[model samples]
Target: MSEDLEFDCGGNRGDGRLIYTVTQISYEIKLILEDSYPTVWILGEISNFKLYNSGHIYFNIKDKNTQIRVVIFQSASINLTFSPKDGMKVLICGRVSSYPKRGDYQVIVNRMERCGSGELYEAYGELKERLKAEGFFDESAKKPIPDIVNKIGIVTSQDGAALCDILKVIDSLNANIETLIYPVRVQGKEAEKEIPQAIEYFNSNHKDLDVLLVGRGGGSVEDLWAFNMESVARAIFASEIPVVSCIGHEVDFTIADFVADMRAPTPSAAAEMVLRSRNDIKKRIEFLRESLNGAINFILYDRSVELDKLILSRALTKPYLIYEDKISYLDELDNRLLKSIGSLFKSKSENLGNVSHRLDIVSPLSVLRRGFSICFDSNNEVIEDSKDVNVGDDISIRFASGSLNAKVKSCE
Candidate 1:
């Protein structure tokens, strides 16, 4: 066997040999492992579990058929929740590679999961319960939908029946509302990442949208798993814009329904929920018009009645008669004044006659006629006796209308 495996010499050399270094051998093994196995999922029971002081985890995965060594780096090791025991079943996600120094193949685990019947479903339920207890489904966390939606954003698949249904509904009911579509995958492994990413994009970008409708048409639980994912639920809850979830049929409820601001049974129903019916608005306008017309007619009728009463009153019909009656009263007063003047003159003549009779009784001439005489000094005067006469004084005497003048010769 040694003679058949002899090495061939090509130039000057100490012996006929082919040389290979440790580093070169290890590099070739690394390339081969990377190219052949790549990344894969391995399910087996854990055995010979060990932890290094460097915080790395070393374990063996074994089945009845075969066994393989596994290593989880320190970064991934610290995040693991469950400890690996010798006989526990696990599913490891990792890349296959060979160690250079020891010349052995192992799996570098990135993630680990416990394997059992309905394990994925169990994980889903556990995560859901945990998030619910954290208040992710509280009513206070929900946003409010706008009353009059003008610009609407939709997150769903681009080539989906739900999109067409929504567009048709909006066009039939409220043609004026504008819609923006954000296309995303609706199912499969990529859906879990793409759907949530699309939701987050709209949350960050679509500030002008009145509301966002996030959903797809009806599907099975597995088909709708993307909407049930924690990533999608968080995106819906954290959205600044109000989200209306329309993910499935009326009977179906998803995590999105609990986290969204509003929920609709279908895409068409979501569109209808956003827009007001045209006939309803028309009926309101007609009712208001009728009320305005009725009010105006009532006011006009009241004003017309007041104006008719004013025109038909006595003051309006017989204004000239009121002036004529006033003039007749003045004429009667003038005739009465003339008759009073004539009566006053007659009374004045009678009063004057009585005054003359009274004056005759008290006259001085009457006293003279009674044989009493008024005496004066001798200048054309009558003497009462001889003593009133002076020597050479002129004297006068009168009786009725006759008079005599004499010179006094003696005085007694």
Candidate 2:
């Protein structure tokens, strides 16, 4: 198939030579536009901003009278200093080129930035997001401010009104906190470096400092830009001592404020925040003293009541009652002892009588008293049977009254 051809200057040329296709024509135009304006800076307000899944951003820069399409490819979008929104005024730098497929010319932006205060504001937001992602602004990372602040280290210009204002407020509140100043520029090219250095120095050298006040007097965002720097933010984050940020008026916010342990609306407010008022402290002390007195008085009164009870005790009141009780107890014990002894003797006497009656039942002497006599042979052994005696044997007869000698005659 043959494609349709057109020529830019075709009326002449005799032999009909300068013929070109639509694609060739579009490429020619694209080259001309790109060469004419290799790079240009344009100022306009963004009307339509669309970020695609392909990582390219499509948008329109519009004025009341006209508008132009702009595309930021992935490479340029990755370097964007801020997240751009519709209606935001911006100054873009890019080269104009035509798309051959659509046969349309547009600006291919290489770099984009916000204009005026928008620039600083955009950087601020970007940094805030980045640091937040890094956990620098986390509550868990922040050190807790002590309830009682004794010494404060200030990082600000010594001559600045911020320092003066802070001192005045501290004096007005009658705070017991003492201050140590580490003078540094609050705004300038050197401020970013000096501020971080000051923070580090104080942290390393002053171990007793309870808190740090970092801020400057009220000014524009540019004037307060030093506090927004990454160095200052990281320095505040790394500090072991609790940092109190008071970078501007109540309405202004900075990166340093987010990274600090505490944030106050103004420098004066920071001073008062770090320490309690002397009047409040005095009231606390007074309350403690009164409580201590109450506790001691209670103890003393209880002990006094106990002493009164002891003084009126029965043993202490009559004294002689002690001896009387003891003597009564001793007499009762003696009577019990005597009764026990007499009972023991009566019991033993009855036992002896019984034993004597038993002995009379079994005693040979009792038999003898009944007129029975025991006969003993020459060997002095008692003869129980008549066969034990001989006719002419001499023997002894044992009577109950007396034993007598006799000669045995006959068994009968």
Candidate 3:
């Protein structure tokens, strides 16, 4: 399809040339630029970087000669690990689009990143260091993966290829394991909260889970930034159940990987590890059953041989022999008992005599019988000093066995 251009050459009628209004020219140029370049990745230095109140980011990507305006809406920009700054060298990927009002072409940025020195990687390293200092990555704190996992929780996007890979492995193994799928955003800003929330939910409420498989498929550093979040690492560390991190490719590692109980190279690898040989469990059980049968037979044979010997022994075959030995043993025991009883009685008698002697020495009646008498006032209180008695006071004299009442006639 083709449209004719109405030529208005400088407002004078019809010189055979295509001269269009400013608006028409701008529209044609915009359509040509947009339709020609569907998408582009531009390398340039950031200048006049601005994040608007409307949550849209505006910036210009420029090299030596010219610059192009760039805009990344909130949805894409929110996933940025590091804040974009002016004078920062960056690589931006977007489509070329024109603003009709200004008639200016700009790149509608879909993604942005620092070019040479990746700010996202630096931020990842910093977060890793911080978590390491906090002992989130300490091997000592890591829980051990159960040798036999019966139930496991999966925290990942339900529809992700990684989940499909994991489920395939698990299903193939025929592992009789209960699986609880906790679907979450695997990438982007929402993933930061969603991933950690799933981990916390499993830890707080799902105590019965044998293990947790937390991860997603491989992606760029920014795309996998959620797994590197501090909250996610803390949640993994806080889990009472063991967590196996299967994040990204074999080469990629996240904070969650370090803090997790175990790290699987991939999601399928994680699934394989969680249930090591479930499909072969029947074979193992059969082998064990044979082993037990053999052991029991061996044990029974040995026991029968011993029983034969015991039955043939003198104790059973010649019953009176046992009774004869037992009779002798009883006599010996009787003599020993008699001697022990006599020795015990002698020792007890000696101990009692010693105790009685000590008691006699400490007895108050012993001192009184040694010819001392106690005097009491009229109130019958013991009078130990002469000052305790007065001339008009009645007194009582107490001997060892008896007491007599007396009236105090003189002071002396």
TM-score of each: 0.45, 0.46, 0.44
lDDT tens digits, residue span 181-235, model 1: 9899998889888887877887777778888989999865568778888888888
**Cα lDDT for residue 323, model 1?**
83
Model 3, global lDDT? 0.85
Give the per-residue lDDT of model 2 (tens digit) for 147-244: 77778899999989999999998888777677889999999989999999999999999979999999998875579899999999999999999999
Considering lDDT, which of the candidate structures 1 and 2 is the better prediction for this target? 2
- List model 3 lDDT by residue over 1-412, tens digit each: 1133454434445766566777667777889888987667677899999999888999889979999999999998997867889989886767798986698899987777676665665677798898889888888998777767888899999888889999999888878778999999999889989988998898888999999999999887678888988888888888898999999877566788889999998999999987885545667899999999999999999999999999999988999998999999999999999999999999999999999999999997888899888998977788988877878788988888997888877765
User: Candidate 1, after superposition: displacement of residue 6 in Å?
Assistant: 99
lDDT of each: 0.80, 0.87, 0.85
Evaluated against the true structure, the overall lDDT of model 2 is 0.87
lDDT of 1 at 13: 62
Best model number under lDDT = 2
- With a 3 Å backbone cut-off (N, CA, C), the pairs that clash in candidate 2 are none
Clashes of 2: 0
**Which stretches of candidate 3 lie above 4 Å from their native place?**
1-115, 277-285, 294-412
